[model samples]
Every structure is written in C-alpha cells, then in structure tokens.
Target chain A: MPEIRVVNFSKHFGKVRAVDNVSFDVKDGEFVALLGPSGCGKTTTLLTLAGIYKPTSGEIYFDDQLMNNVPPKYRNISMVFQNYALYPHMTVFENIAFPLKAKKMSKEEIEKKVLEVTKKLMIDKLLDRKPMQISGGQQQRVALARALVKEPAVLLFDEPLSNLDAKLRMMMRAEIKKLQSDLGITSVYVTHDQAEAMTMASRIAVFSMGKLVQYGTPDEIYNEPKNMFVAAFIGNPPMNFMENFKVQSKDGELFATRGDIMVKLPPKAKEVKFEKTEGLVLGFRPEHCKIAKKEVENSIPANVYVLEPLGRDLIVNLKVKGVGGESELIKIFAEPGMNFEIEEKVYIIPDPEKLHLFDPETEETIL
Target chain B: MAELRLNFFQRNSSKISQAVMIIILVLITSPILLGYAWLILRSFSVDMVHGFIPTKLTLKNWRFLWQEMKGYPNIWRTFLNTFWIALWVMILEALITSMGGYALSRYDFPGRTSMLRFILVLHAFPSISLMVAIYYVLKVIGLLDNLWGIILLKASLEIPWGTWVMKGFYDGIPWELEWAGLVDGYGRFEVWRKIVIPLVKPGIAVTAIFAFLSGWSEFVFINTFIFSQNAWTLSKYVKGIIGDFRFADYGLLTAVGLFYVIPTIVFFFFVNKYMIKLTIGGVKG
Candidate 1:
C-alpha cells in the first residue's frame, strides 16, 4: 500500500471552484473519509484523487510520485460507487472478474480470484445472478467483491451505502470498515452521513463550500471542532448556537452575556485572548445542556416548548428570549422519564467545561 | 337510497370505460382490417363483385411467383435487390448513428451544440424537397440507377433520427458505469464496446427496425433514381406494373402489393415488443 498525499489541490469547472486549495494526506493502510453536504467539494476531491478529474492546480502524490497527469486506468485505484454500478447485463461472477480480465489474467487465475473474493464477501451463491436479479445489498457486496478482487493500491468509496435501506446501510458500514482494516488497503471514503463517517473513518476531513474546514479523528472532530461549520456538521440534532453574546469581565472573571441570559466562563476558556468581546456566539451540543426545575449557577430561564420522546431519551425544546427581543428555540436531551408541560418555565444550563465560543464574523472557534 | 343510484355509475365506471375502449378500437381499425381482407381476397380470386363477392377462385394472379412477366424482371430478382438494400441500410444506419450518437452524448468539444442543432435542422427538412439536389449528386457520382446509391441515400436520410434516438438511450445510462470501467483499467474505447454498447441494445434494435422498414418501403428515391429493370426493387417493380392505370391487372397488382407487404408485417411481428417498449421509454424519458 502507498501513502496518498495531496498538496494544495484545487479543481475548477469553468468558473465554479468545486474544490479549493484543499490539502490532506492518507497514511498507508489508513481509512479516511471526505465528509460534507452536497456540492461541498468532498466528492470532487475524491474524484480528483481517483484521477477522474485533473487538478486545476497543485499536485497529488502517491508516496512522492506525482499523479497530477495520470489517467484513472493507470492510477491503480478502485472505486465502489453509491449505486454499486454493477453491470446489469453481467452476472455477479463476470462483474467481479471484469478488472481481472482487463489485466489480461488467465482464465483459471481469474476464476480462482473471483471465487475467493466472492466467498469472502459471502456472495459465492449469487455468482450466476445478474445485478437486476439480486437485492440491493447483494449488489453492494458484488461491487465490493469487484473492487477487492484486484487488490488495488487505493480503494475509494463514493457514498456506497446511500442507496441501501437504513438497516442495511448500518450493516454495510460495519462490514466495509472491518473489510478495509482486514485488507489494510489505503482507502478514501466520501460520504455526507455524519454517523457513517464517525463510525468508519480513522480520521475525517470535513469540507464546506469547497474548502477543507477541519481534518481530525472522529472524537477530535466531535469534541473539539476547529470551527462553527465542523461543530454544527459533525453532531446529530446538531450543535445549537446562541448568537451575538457580549463578553464582559466582572471582578476579573469573564461571562458571556446577552439580554437577561448570562453564562460564566470555565477556567479553561480564561487562557484564550479575545480580540473582539462583542458579537461572540455561544455554542453547545444538545446533550451537554442540562434542564433544571429551579435556577442553578449561570442558568438561563426558559419556557418548555415541546418534548420529543426518543426511546431512552427525551429531547426538550426550550424557548428563550434573545438579545434581539425574539424567541429562540434550543433543544437539550433529557431522560425519557422527565416530563414538562408546554409553556412551563424552567432553567437550562450549558456545561461550562464543554461550552464553545465562536467569533460570529469568522465563524471560527475561540474556545 | 338516492345516493345509491348516483354511486351506481361510479361503481361500474371501469367496466363502462372498458366497453367504450373496445368499441372505439374496433371502429378505428375496421377500415384497415377490411382493406387487408380485400387485398388477400383479390390476390387469390379471378374476379369480384361489389368489392366483396368473388366470382371464381384461381391461382392465376400469383403466377408471377414462378413465371416471368413481360417487361419485368423475375420476382426473386426484385425481392433480393430490395432485401439487400434494406439490410445494408439497416446495418449502416445502426453502425454510423450509434457511434455518432455516443460521441455527441459523451464528449464535449467545440461545435458539439452546433452539430446537434444542425442534425435537428437536417431532419426537419423534407427529403422530397431535396430530391432535385440528390438526383444531381447521384448523377455526378455515376451511381444513378444503382441499388447501392439508393441504399446510401436512404441510410443517410434516416441517420438524424437514429442518432437522436440513440443519444437519448445513451443519456439514460449512468456515467458511473463508465467511470467504474475506467477505474477498472480499461481504455475508453474498450469500455464503450464492452459496457456501453451492450446496454443500448434496445436503442440499436429500434434504429435498425426503422432503417430497414424505411429502406424496404422507399418509393420516390428508387423510382426516380433506379431506371434499369435489373436493379428494380419491389416498390419500383410494383409501380411499373401499374403504368398509366389502363389495362392494369388488378389481381396481379393486389398479389404483388400483398407480397411486398408480407415481409414488413412479418418483421413487425418479430420485433413488436421492442417497438412498444421504445414508445413507452421515449415518452417517459
């Protein structure tokens, strides 16, 4: 396996910059994911890495060998498309054997290799079945078998589980992650699903609007996101933002204050220098906010708007008055047994140690 | 109840609509059905009364099947000529249009839009209006009265439509399949031949059918360009037998006309499924 290095890569379609000056590296035998929403340059970066699109500028290297001008066929990279892309006319065996046949492998070798991969993927019984005759999950396995049979230098996946049902997607996600690690092939997976990226990738590269916003491990991305985009994009129920809070120092202790709501800064946040005290946004994850029957230290009073029962946990949506004199809704996960009637007044406090502060102008994390 | 009476028609609406559909279909198809019946009857009978009554049954009208008529080549000679031209046009049109359509659909080059627009304009112009120019071109190329010339002319005329239809089918194939092939280490042409072509078999079948049927039934081009009796196709030969419309053998004309149409009818039956699917696919797409 070869380590993949991309240096200041950019791609433009006419005037639209699909991927802009993004740079990252995939260590040999490591599984990395390019994650973002639609048209966020994740797919574009993957295609460029696969040699489907030439870089508009900068260079790509596979262990110090420049790959900017290489064609896809010569790149020795295999991709599993989101649709699976198994040839509808060909049987599963034939589909798996396509790359081998292209390499001019002998018939016996091709059959042996195809059978071995199919057996591993648990699709040996489906060898004679065409793509249309098989189920979507079966087709997915066939596509994986095709990509694996050749033992490519790099295995690329383009949202390969997006076509499967929710249950099957989770199943395939675990299967693919295990398979990639077992084979120890350098791989780059592209996806918009945050759960898949968090569970499967050794490290995740989050993109937004054609720029690489943050590249870190799943825990790092979730717990210490570098910016507001990564913080919002990487979490479920998403990160909540209380915007336009002014930082004030009272008796040498900093507090983020907006209208009647005030929050004391934790000891860890005191070390960071704040260039602009005003227009700072306070960010916190839904799970980090605590609901209280009575006011606690640094707690903001809120009205219980609604309660969403989700099995073991309940999501409590609270309405609070903002600095602009408008009602803002914030959600926090509470125990399912907890109950609150609509329009009931309560106090919600954010975990001081886990709270995030961002500069509204730059959208970058200050703490 | 009064509501029950109102709901009665609504409940039986499906059955009523089915009955209405059958009646409409029969009414629309009865004239063509009667014409076909008359053609078959006239070809096998010696005479007829009131256009339906046959005076005598005989095999004389169909004698041209084995016997040579004056001023006409053998029936087999004309049939073979027509068959060869139609076959060539079918093959040539399918080949050229499939390749052209693939290029127009896949590749982005300068003048691609202009070329597509030009093809639409070419198809829009009636071939009849260009007969004078086509005649002079054929004469200049020394291919007048040649079956090859007619075959070339018919195939070229059908190309715009064939190319357009094939492009639509090609457009329906996902780009990821080609990308997979490329990533699988196959050259672009190899991917096209092994993957893309097989997927568009229905498009090729529809194009070939249209080309063959048009070439088989072509009259104006063959009548004006092909002058020799040896090179006469079934269409021109049938026209020759009806010269001046005086003293024409109505029975033989019917026999020959029915004979000329038999292959078309047979071919239609053989590929009817593709034709139906093509219409639905075209409309839905």
Candidate 2:
C-alpha cells in the first residue's frame, strides 16, 4: 500500500482558486476525511489526489513517487463517486469485473475474482441485475464492489453516501468504515457532513474558503479547534459566540466582559497570550454550559426565548441581558423533562475549561 | 383546478375526445397510407392503367425484373450497386461520426465552440447547393462517376449532421462513467470504446439506418455524375423507365418502386426490435 502525501497543492480555474495551497499526508491504512461546507475546496483536493484534476502547482507523492504527470489510470487509485457512477449497461457481475477485464486477465480468473468480491459483499444474488434494477443501497454496494475488485494501492470517495436516505446513509457509513479498516487501504473521503467525519475518520482535515484550516484527530479538531470557523463548523448546533466583548485586565489577571456582568477565565489562560484588548470574542460550546434556576457565580442572567426538546436533552435559546440593555442570544443544552418554559428567567454558568476566545478581526482562536 | 378538470371531462365524454383524435390522425396520415395502397395495387396491374383503377392483374412485370439478369436488361446489377454503396456509406459514416462527435463533446480546445457552430452552419447549406463545385472537385481528382466516390461523398456530407446527433447522445452520458473507466486502468480511447460507444447504441442505430436510407435513395448526385450504363444505380434506372415523351411503363415502375421501399422498411424493423430493448439500461437513473 502506498501512503499518499500532498504538499503545497493548489488548483486554479481561471480566476477562482478552487483549491488553495494545502498540504496533508495520509498514512497507509488510515481513513482521513476532508470535511468542509459547500464550495470549501474539499472536493477539489480529492479530485486532484485522484488525478481527475491535475494540480496547478506543488507536488503529490504516492509512497514518495512524484505523481504530477501520472494519469488517473496509472495512479493506481480507485474512486467511488457520490452518485455511485455504475455502468448502467452492464450487470453487477460485469461492472465489478470491468477493471479486471481491463487488465486482460484470464476469463476464468476474472469470473472467479468477481464472484469472490460479490460473495464477500453479500451481493452475489444481484450478479445478473442491471444497476437500475437494484435498490439504491444495493447500487452503492455494487459500486464498492467495483472499486474493491481492482485492489488498488489507494482509495478515494467523494461523498459516496450522500445520495442515500438518512437510514441507508447511516448503514452505509458504518459498512464503509468497517470495510476500509478491514482492507487497510489508505483512503481520502471528501464530505460536508460533520457527523460523518466525526464518526468515520481517523483524522479530519477541515477546509474553508479553499484553504485547509485545521488538520487533526477528531478529538483534537472538536476539543482544540484552531479557529472560530473550525469550532463553529464542527459542532451540531455550533459553538455560541459572545462577540464584541471588552477585554479587561485587573489584579494581574485577564477577564472578558460586557461591562456590567463579569466573566471567568480558564486556569490556563495565563499560558495563552493575546494583547489586543479593544475587540475580542468569547465562545463556549452549548453542551458545556448549563442553565441554573437560582442566580449562580460567574453567570449571565437570561430569559428563555424557546425550548426545543431533542429526545434526551432540550436546547434552550436564551436572550442574555447585556450591558446598556443589549441582548446576546445563547443556546444552552439542558436535560429534557425539566418543565422549562419560554420567558423563564435563568442563569447560564459556562465551564471555564470549555470556553474559547477569538480576535474579532482575525476570528482565529486565542486559546 | 382539479374539480374544474373533473367537471369538464365529465361534461365532455372521453369517447368524443378519442374520436376527434382518431379523425385528426387519420386525416394527417391518409395521404401516405393511400399512396402505399395504390402502389401495391399498381404493382399487380399488367398494363398502364390510369385514373386510379386496376384494369388487369399480372406478375409479368415482377418476373421481368427478377428473371432478366442477363445483358443490358438486368435490374439486379443496379440494385446491387446501390446496395453496396449504401452499406459502405453507413459503415464509414457511423465510424467517423462516432469518434468525431465524442471528441467534440468531451474535449475543450481552441476554437472548439466555433468548430461546432461551423459544422451546424455548413450543414445549413444543402449539398445540392454545392453540386457544381463538388462535381468539379471530383473531376479534378478523377473519381467522378465511381461508386467509391459516391460513397465517400455521401459519408462526408452526412458527417456534420451525424456528428451533432451523436454528440447529443454523448452529451446525455455522464462523464463519471468515463472517469470510472479511467480509475479502472483503461486508457482514454479504451474508455471511449468500452464505456461510451456501448452506451450510445441507440444513437448509432438511428444514424446507421438514416445514412443507409439516404445513400439508398440518392438520385440527384448519381444522376448528375454517372453517364455510362456501367455506373448506373437503382434510382437512375427507375426514372429511366419513364421515357422522354413521359410515356412510361407504370406497372413496371410501380413494381420497382415497391422493391426499392422494402429494404428500408425491413431494416427499420430490424433496428427497432433491438433499439427498444438495448436503450432500456443504456443511461443511468
């Protein structure tokens, strides 16, 4: 198996920089997800790695062999597209055997390998059926079967589960994850779904505006986001931002506040340094903070605007009463069946360890 | 809107709508269907019976066409010549248009759009308009009045329109199919052959039949180019039946015309039988 590495890769289409200077290395047998929102250049990076689009500059190395001039056929990589891209004219047997037939293998060997793959994938009964004759989940399995029959050095997937319904998508997601690890093939999967990345990837490379913003493990990306975008993009309801806060220093300690209410800093705040005091934005995860009925220490008083019950927990959208009668909307995750009602006065106690701070101008994380 | 449509359909019985549709369809198609009926009747007539009525019935005209294969009276030689030309034209046109259409559809190069537009503009002017120029070019090349020359010329003239038709079919095929082939370790041309060409079977079928028919029924070029009896084709001899004074063998002419139309109908049926089933899974859902 060849380990795939991309260094300073950039792809430009006329004036648009579809993929800016980006670099990452996927170890053999590791599943890496290129996660981003729409138009975030994750797809471009995957396409470049697949040799579908040649990199405008920089170098791609598969096992330290420079691949700038390698065509996709010679790149020894297999891709499962989002739409499955099954050969509609061919039956499942023929579709799975296409790459083997391209190699000019013996007919007996081709049939044997196709049967083996179909049986392993539990799709042998569909051998005679065309793609349109099968269900969507079956078609996805056939696509995987086609990609696996070749036994390429590396694998690539472009939102392969995006076409399936919610239930099927989850089922396929687990199946693909298990299959990837079982095969131990270096794979780069491109998708925009946070939960898919969080659940399937060994490591995640989060992208934004054609740039690679953060490359880390799932825990590192979620718990130690490098910027506001990663922090906001990684979470489901997204991290709540308390922006335009005045940074105050007194008694040899730093505090961010809206003038009337006070804020608590994490214990390690002294180790994280930022000097710009005029414009600062504080962020904390919704699940990390809690709603208290009684007034609590280092808390902000707020009135609940809406309470959405999400089975196990409720999302309380609170309008915090700030200085000068200004309001900052905050979401707090609370246990369900608490009988929380709208317009109820409550206090938000944020955990200092889970708090994040950012510069208003750069929007990059300060700690 | 649903209630209004229901009320309207209830007020006007469906039988009236069906009857009106049948009447309109019959009125539109009666001319061609009646012509076929008259031709069949005339083919059985023994003499030049006029005024839309058959006087005497005989197979003598057909027997003459079938039996007289010797000397200058032979019709089979001219039929073979036309058939050979049509077959060659169909094969050559299909091959050239398929590759040319695929290249234009999949690749982008300098003047690509202009070239596609140019093909359209060139086809806009009928080949009949350039007959003199074509004849002079062929005469200079010393290929005029030759069967190969006619076949090549027909294929060339049909390429522009045929390319566009094939390109429209190729456009309907997703590019991911080719990409999958590429990932499967097939080269570019191999992908076109193994993936693309098979997927466009319907387009190829229709184009081949059209090219074959166009070459089969060609009259103006063969008439204008050919002079000697050795170069004579089916259409020329069919017209030759009517003499200079317009006094011609109507029964023999109708018999030959019926013979000429049979291949096209048979070929269409043959192509259609497979086209319907083959087109079923050629495109992705």
Candidate 3:
C-alpha cells in the first residue's frame, strides 16, 4: 500500500456531491497538490484525507491500515489551516507547544521542543507575542512551526499562504517547499493557484466538479493533459479551443480547418478519412503558437483582436471564424516589444508536435 | 486630523443637536444624581430640622442600620444569604450560557432556530403571569420559602440573555481555532476548556456580573418565596426597615439604601469595560 490511498472516495451533502468518487495515491515522502478552482472539491478532498470529514462511501487507507473511522488527531497527521488558526489567547510558544502538552509531555520537554521548532523556523523572537501582534509573514512561519512540532506522519496544508500578499506568498512558497523536502514528510497541499502547484508540488491532481480529472507529475500534466479540461485549466491564459473542426482534403492535401483558420494535417493525420465532423475540437497553448511574418506552410490566418502587454510578453488575442460562421478568440503569446494594431491580420503557425485534438462528445483527448 | 477634522459634535459646524443632546443628558441624569445626593445627605442628618440637607454629620444611622433592624437578621447574616444566592446564580448562569451558546453558535440540528427563538419567548410573559405555576411547582418540589428556589429561578430566567451575549462573542471567534485544538489531539471538552473558554472570558464576565446583580437585587421572588427573617436578602432587609411605618428613621432607611447600592456600584466598576463592549445580540422581546 502507498503512504496514503484514497479509493473511490465520495462525500455527499444531502443532494449535493461535495467530492465524487475521488481516488488517488500519495507515495512516501511525496508532496502532492490538490489543485482546482473554488468549489471544485479540492479542499473537500484534502479535508477527507485529514480525517476531518468522513467519506460517505469509499475507503481511505494509511500505510495499509483502514482510516475511514479514524479521528483526525489519531490519524497522526497535522494540518495548517488557511487562516493560520493560531490561538489568540495563547502566546506563540504555547501555540507551538500545544500538541506536546496534549500528549502530557513534561513542561521542560514542551518548552525544549517548542524552542527547537521555533528556532528552525526563525520565529524564536516571537515566542512571547500573540498571533495578531505579529506580521503576516511571521505568522505564517509560526503556523508552520506549530504544525511541524508534532512531527506527524503526514502534513496537510490548506492554502496556508493564501492570506499573504503576493510578495510574501512567493517567499513562503519557496520556504515551504524547502522545509517539506528537508523533513522528508508526505504532504498534501490544497490550492487553487496553478502557479503555486506547478512550482512547488512533486505531483499535481486537478479536480473539477467534484471529480479528479487528472493526476500526474507537473511535466506530464502540463505537456500531456488527458482531456480538454486539464489542457485548458493547467496553463496561464489557458489553452485555445476551436470547436467542431473538420479535416478536409482539398486538391490532395488534408487540412484541419475551421472558417478562415487552416492547418495542414501531419503525415499521421493525413491517412485518416474524414467528413466534416462536429465531434472534433482543436486545441493548442498560447505559448506554442508563433506569429508568421509571411505565409508559412501549414499556417492558419487570424486577426489580432487585441494586444495585452504583461511585462516580458504580449498576449495577442486572435479572432477567427469557424466552419459554422461563428467567430472565436484564441490567445497567442508574442515576444515583448512586438506591437500589433487591433484588427491586424497575423498568421498563426501552431506547433505541430504541441497541438491537441479532442473529441467533444467524450471530452477525451484524441492526440 | 489633517482632513478637515470636525469637533466630536459636528463636521459641518452644526450646534443645535449638540445643545439638545446635552439638555437631554442632564435631564436624564439629574433625577438619579439628585436622589442619590439626597440619600447621602439624609444619611448624615442629625435631625429633621436639616430639611433635606445635613447641617451636622452623625454615625448613629450607620451604626443602627449595620447593628440592628427589626423584622430581619443582623446585617452580616442577611449579607451571607444574599452573597450565597448571588454566587450560586452567577456560577449556574455562566455554566449554562457557555454550553448553550457554544452549541447555538457552532452547530445546526433539528429545532435549533426555534430553540433560539423559544428561549427568548420564555421571557415574553411577565414573571407575575408565571408566578402561580412556579409557586405550585416549588410547592410540589418542597422548595417554597427556600433560598435555593429563588436562586434557581433567577439564574434560569437569566440564561436567555446570557446565552445571546455568549453566542455573539462566539460568533467573532473563528471555527478554525477550535478545529486546530481538535487536530492537536484535544477532545471536544478539552477543546472548550483550553481554547473556547479562555477566548470568551469577557463575555463570561458580563454574564456573571448581570446574573450576580439580578440575584442581589431580586425583590418579588425573594419577598414571596422567603418567609423567614433568617432567609432574608439585602432587598428584603431594606423592605423590612420600612415595616409598620411608626417612628420611621428616614436617616436609617437612607443609610441602608446607600449601603445596598455600594456592592453593585463597586462590582460594575470592575467589569464596566467588558460590559460596554459586549455584542449582546438583539434578542426579540
């Protein structure tokens, strides 16, 4: 059995399914991120794993022992809540020493352990202050120190950096990633931030509508998404979608085209026969598409609908018509300092190796 | 201060409302202050010729009031009775509200909303209306004319408002704080003891103070339920000083009245800060 195994787990709140048949395995010493938009069941899944919630149906196992009936504290896991949840009445040292005191440790032992953990987190100076009296960044460190003091088998983080500002979040992200690896603890982090998950997690599990849609390494999830949902959700600016595309052969050349946008089929796709099909959806990432100065082979024509400059890069929103006479917008990233007027016609040459094709009816990737 | 600061009274230099507010404040406070002044003056008067003002100070009234009063026990004996009753009421009130308010604030169950409403409804009918039923119940329980009976009644009546104040305070505490304790290996009871109780100390102080004062000043229930002079509280003792009205000592009565107000005044001064800031959520009358 893996360090943690959740098999066919489901939690239903009356008529609503909060986490539906979610299943995943976390290896020993692995940091897995549960990532999704709000209300997508990521946090619900994390809570279930923490034993804070009892799954309505399914099995949870820790180190091969059944855990569905285990209370949170007995499960030998610690969770750092999103709000930090430091006791307002307790000093910082007491907050970190709480678990030890609960275990009936001697006063000197509790104090020694608290000092050791606080020193490690560099929050030793804040031992006498209350949570509210400390900076947000310092509070984050204290929350982590408190959670780590118990040295539980697994660590759970519920968007612990969500309350921090962008600069502090970034700094704490690096700190948490380093601390987790140094301790070699099996950790499950819940966050809706794609950037955070992509940067810190050893593996990613993407959830939507109470279901785990994809679970794999960051590289695999980003480069080889299993479905349109995973493809569109994993990247910044998201993957562009051209629905109801059809492969057509005009004068002995097979091309996947919708309205004025056209891309010649690769050698492998050239052999497949096609009538105009509604199930076909073409997908590619914004960073994978390049602007062709002149007509490049297998290129598609699109108008630059709008240009948004984001420091190092300019996102060119392309407007193109589909086969059904419906217009669509696709984002394309251009090198910084490149300028294009609105409505400027630009040819987009999507990287053949990076293009994604999906069957809309099944919502599964075809290539 | 730099942003065109207004005096506390007005930002646009309006003075009419401010003037009216001062007038109303004096109008409301003058009676209470003047009556207190008259009581203090009469307590010191050596003779009726002083006519609401004391010309010469005397300790005879204080001495007689503290040492002897007809139809009641000594001041120390009555003080003990009142002290025990108020202490019991305060402890019971604090215990009931902490649990009741925690449940109301943190959980949802069948009839929770109605229960919250129903507790306040218990206060809707006048105590006089319920007195007959309460009297019979006490008769059946063999608690009539018992000091414990009065203590129970006062504390029970206070649970509704005390619970509401407690619930308001609990509303401000994050549920995550409780959850952290649970995850820290503390049981639910331990969590309340270690986490919830300490954080809600101010709310508890307000509840205890109100309960103590209500018990201390209770009149009707004590007057009806307590028939023995030995069982009399400070309120009954004060009433006893006015018994029969023949050769009444206005100075003695005033001295006792001032003494009766001292404990409350001193008690309020201790907890006044917390009482002012309590959320004391709006409970429907």
Candidate 4:
C-alpha cells in the first residue's frame, strides 16, 4: 500500500511558484529523495509532506486517508531539520523522551524507549549531557534518536547531513540508510548534493525551477536522462553537448556529418525523421569517450587543451573540430598513467550506444 | 645601568598613562560623590544659619526633620507607595512583554508586520507629549489620586519599550531550537514554555531591570495624577519638600534621595552578571 501520496501539489508564495504541480507516491517502506539545488522547492516539498506547509492547491493522502487539513502533530510524522535542532537546554535523554511524554506515556516506558534509541544510536554515554556540551556530530545523532524514538509512520529529513563535516557526513549517511531499512518506514529525504542523493535514495526525483524534471532509479537518471537539464544536473563532470550535423542520404544509406567527424547512421538513429532547420544536440558522458591509437570508424581527431589529474583517473579536456560554440570543448576520462600534454593532438572515439540526441529547441531527448 | 635605564623607560610611560586615566575617572565621578558626602555632613550640622561647611556636625537637622516637620510620614508613605507601584509595574511589564515578544518572534500571523511597525512607532513617541491627555483621562476615570492608577500607568507606558527589547532578544534565539521542540511532540505553547522562555531568562532580567528603574524614578505622571498626601510616591514627596521656599529642607531631601538611590544601586549590582550574560547570549544565539 502507498504510505503517502501527493496529488497535483502546487504551492505559490506571492509572485513566485515554489512547488508547481508536483505529485509523487511513497510506498510503505521505500526511501525517496527530493533532490535539487537551493530554491528548487525540495525543502518546500518535504515541509509540505511534514504538514508544516499547507499546499496552495492540492490533496495529500496517507494510507488512503486524506491529510489535506491535518496539522503537523496529527500527521504522525517526524522531521529532522538541517541544523539538527536539538533542544539546547535539554539533555539527550530529555530531548529523546519529550515526544513520549507528550503522548502521555508512562515515565518508565518513556525512559525505556529513550534508552533503547540512545543505545541504538551509540549515544548512551552522552544521554545526560546537554547539547551544547556535546560535539556537533553527537548532537546530530541525538537529533536522529529523538526523531526515531517516536516511531512515527513516516520520517522526513531536510538536508540533515549538510552541516556535518565530509567524513562524518558519509558515516551518518550509512547509519541513516541502515536505520531506515531496519525500521521499514517510508522516508522522504531532501538534499542538494547529487552524490548524496544518488548514494542514499532508492529512487530520486530531480527538481529544477520548481518542477520535477525526472523521477526514477539512480541508474535510469544517470543513463537515460529525459531532458538537457536533468542530464547536466545529475552527473558530476556533466554530459558534454555538441551541435548536430545534417544527415545526407546516399544510395538509400543515411550519413551524419560535422567537419572531420562523420559516421553512418545506426539502425535506431535512421528511423527518426530529423526536422529541417531544427538544430540537434549530441551528448555523451565523459567516461564513455576514449583515446584510440588507431583511427576508428567514427573517431574524431582533437587537440588536448588541458589535463587534470584526479589521482585515480585523468580528465582530458579535448577541443573537437566543428562542434561549434563553447561545447566544442569535450571532457574525456582516461585511466591513470595515460599522459598527455597541452596542444597534443589525439583521437577521441565516443561509444555509439552511449550517444544521446536532443532537440535543441525543446531541450528534450530525441531517442 | 643599561637594564635599569630600560626598566625606567617602560615603567615611566605606563605610570604616566595610568595617572592620566585615574585623573579623568576622578574628574567624572568626584562631583556627584563629593556632593553626596557634603549633603550628609550638612544634614548633621549643629548650626543651620552658619551653613554646614564650617559648622560643627550634629544630628540637629535630623531631629528637626523627625520632630518639627509634618513631612516625615509623607516621606514614609511615599516610599511605600513607590515601592508597591514599581514592584507591580515591573511584574506586569515583564510578563506582558515577554509573552508578547515571544509570540511576535516565533509566530507568523496576519498583520504581524504592520503590528510590529505600529509598536515601533509607539516606542519612538515622546512620553511627555501624552502627559496632559493622560492626566485628563485619569481624572475622567477617577484614577487620579489612586495608587493602582500610578501602577497601571507606569506599566502601560513601559510595556512597548520593554517588549521591543525582549523581541530583539527572542529574535536572536535560533528558530531551529523551537522547531525541534515542536517535532518532539510539543505544541506551540509547550515549545515557548520549555524552550523559548528558558533561553531568554537573561533577556527577561534585563527587561525587568529597565521596567523597575523607569517605574521607580518616574515623576511627571505620578505627580500630575496623584494629589492625595496618602498616595504620593517618593519622587512626588521629594518634590514637595522643595516646593515651598519658606520651608526648604535641602539636607533632609538629600538624605531621602540617597535612600532611594541605594536600592537601585543594589539591584543593579545583583543583576550585573545577568546583563553580561544577556549580551553574550544575544551575540552567540
């Protein structure tokens, strides 16, 4: 059963539409990430799910029960804020036990539950310490314990690891994933970090300019992006885009050409009708481009502009011929020990199966 | 000899700077301190006609004040009345301002921005401009010559400024802490009580001190609205001693002023730590 469903949710703030016509469902135990840059409405969407925000126009359901008018407390959800938001004056024990006390639980039961959560989070030693007395990482753990102690139906996290140092962030990410899996609770995590979203989410919903551009498993998002924005936003070095060339039919065989780079059309590419005067964008991931010693059938000769050594791999920036505009610059990842100097000419052959075509006007993928 | 010369050069410059600072400090504070001492000496002088500076010191003026003048009970009544009015005003001001400030700091409501602007304008208005209207209004309400009237007036006048100070303090408290309480299953009221109020205690102390000092030393409203001898406050009673030129009692008046100032000085000393805490907390939070 779907634990939470947002139906055509749209929230506007004055002249700005923060979340525009967003809709998604969370399965009973699935972990989903609303990933986007700041002001892309990821946090707004999480807040709406937490019931901190009432949608401008939409309906929400939790396990077949409508939650449109429900206040945050009655929604049976717990949220961890970006700042961790541990009560500064309260000891860890009190911070975790507060939710139980609110529910009128017996003092013994509250203590027991608080102790259990503290033990699980490995913060039992710091249970009596105030938040100010503990380190930030410890405080974050206490915040997580406080949220988990309630055993709510859903968990919402708003950039919970953004405040931690890189090493602690990685550690906490693993811990959060393990805890979510163990509890089997539906969770919606919000983060602007693409690496975090890719690593943590069962499926990711990529947002851009207050709209969900794509929602799928990480593999689909990385391999089969639906639009130019998603293709650029999801990858680290980003997909390199070059203008398309006009196709010429000779003896009923189609050939696409741009400068020295020309190739016969693949069976899949030949079936699509290329619109005249409608420009196309060709894209390929950096990792898919390779340096070949021999001239391959569809390889292009390019000059190496810059070489960046990333310890484990080399990022080779190439200047492709006749690609036009700033996108003539293409990135290629080479294995370590592949040495290249500036102005050195090389051959870059992109994998045919990995090539992506987009209609430049609409910015949508062609195939 | 060389080491001695170096020590002399370092020590001489520091000694001169220290001497200059001490001189400036004495120049600023000595007038008030010395005048107060002279008043004490004059109050105990044996001969009033010769003046207190050259005359033998005695308790004659004190005796005259206790036995001959009808002003003694008025002074005592005024002191008690001032104490009650200031005490009640301080309590009322602190409670109303802290709660209102907390709400304004932590909640979003309709007209919140306009309401804040209006309160700021009220705080900026000169209190003296309202004096005549306030007097006539008090007369119509029959609050003139009433003790509760003075308490209510002082509290109402102090609330806007006190609330402004408290609101700034509450604004400095991170909203995350309160939201944490809310997610921990506390309602809004519980969050205010358990988190917001405890965090702003130093602010409450600072606001209380301002309210208390203002109410304690207020003169114009208390004098205008209160005409009854039994309801007079300390400042009003002190003013009465100097009202008539024929029976002016400078020595007695100075002694009473010293008595009134002592409590404020003592109260300030007690809360000095809280004031420092308030400043540091404001910066950190």
lDDT of candidates 1 onward, in order: 0.92, 0.87, 0.85, 0.82
lDDT of 2 at A136: 89
Residues A108-165 of candidate 4: C-alpha lDDT, one tens digit per residue: 9998999899998899999889888998899889989989998988999999999999
Candidate 2 vs candidate 3: the lDDT winner is 2
Error of 1 at A238 (Å): 0.9
Off by over 4 Å in 1: A335-337, B1-12, B282-285
TM-score leader: 1
TM-score of each model, paired residue for residue: 0.97, 0.93, 0.91, 0.90
Candidate 4: which docking quality band?
medium
List clashing residue pairs in candidate 4: B44-B58
Per-candidate iRMS values, in order, are: 2.3, 1.1, 5.0, 1.7
Lowest-scoring 10 consecutive residues by lDDT in candidate 2 chain A? A253-262
Runs of candidate 4 with Cα error greater than 4 angstroms are A244-256, A263-267, A270-278, A293-295, A321-327, B1-69, B74-76, B106-110, B277-283
Q: How many residue pairs clash in each candidate at the backbone level?
A: 0, 0, 0, 1
Candidate 2 ranges with C-alpha deviation above 4 Å: A250-253, A320-329, B1-12, B46-50, B67-73, B243-246, B273-285
DockQ for every prediction shown: 0.66, 0.69, 0.50, 0.57
Best by lDDT: 1
- Regions of candidate 3 where Cα sits further than 4 Å from its true position: A249-254, A265-276, A322-326, B1-24, B46-57, B244-248, B279-285
**lDDT tens string, model 4, B214-239?**
88998988777877778877787678
Question: Comparing 2 and 4 by lDDT, which wins?
Answer: 2
CAPRI-style quality class for the chain A–B interface of candidate 1: medium
Q: Write the per-residue lDDT of candidate 1 for residues A1-367, one digit (tens) a residue.
A: 9999999999999999999999999999999999999999999899888898899999999998999988899999999999988888889999999999999999999999999999998999999988988898999999999999999999999999999999999999999999999999999999999999999999999999999999999999999999999999988899989888988888888898987788988888789988988989899999997889887879889999998888888899998888757988898997557789999999988888889999988989998
lDDT of 3 at A133: 90
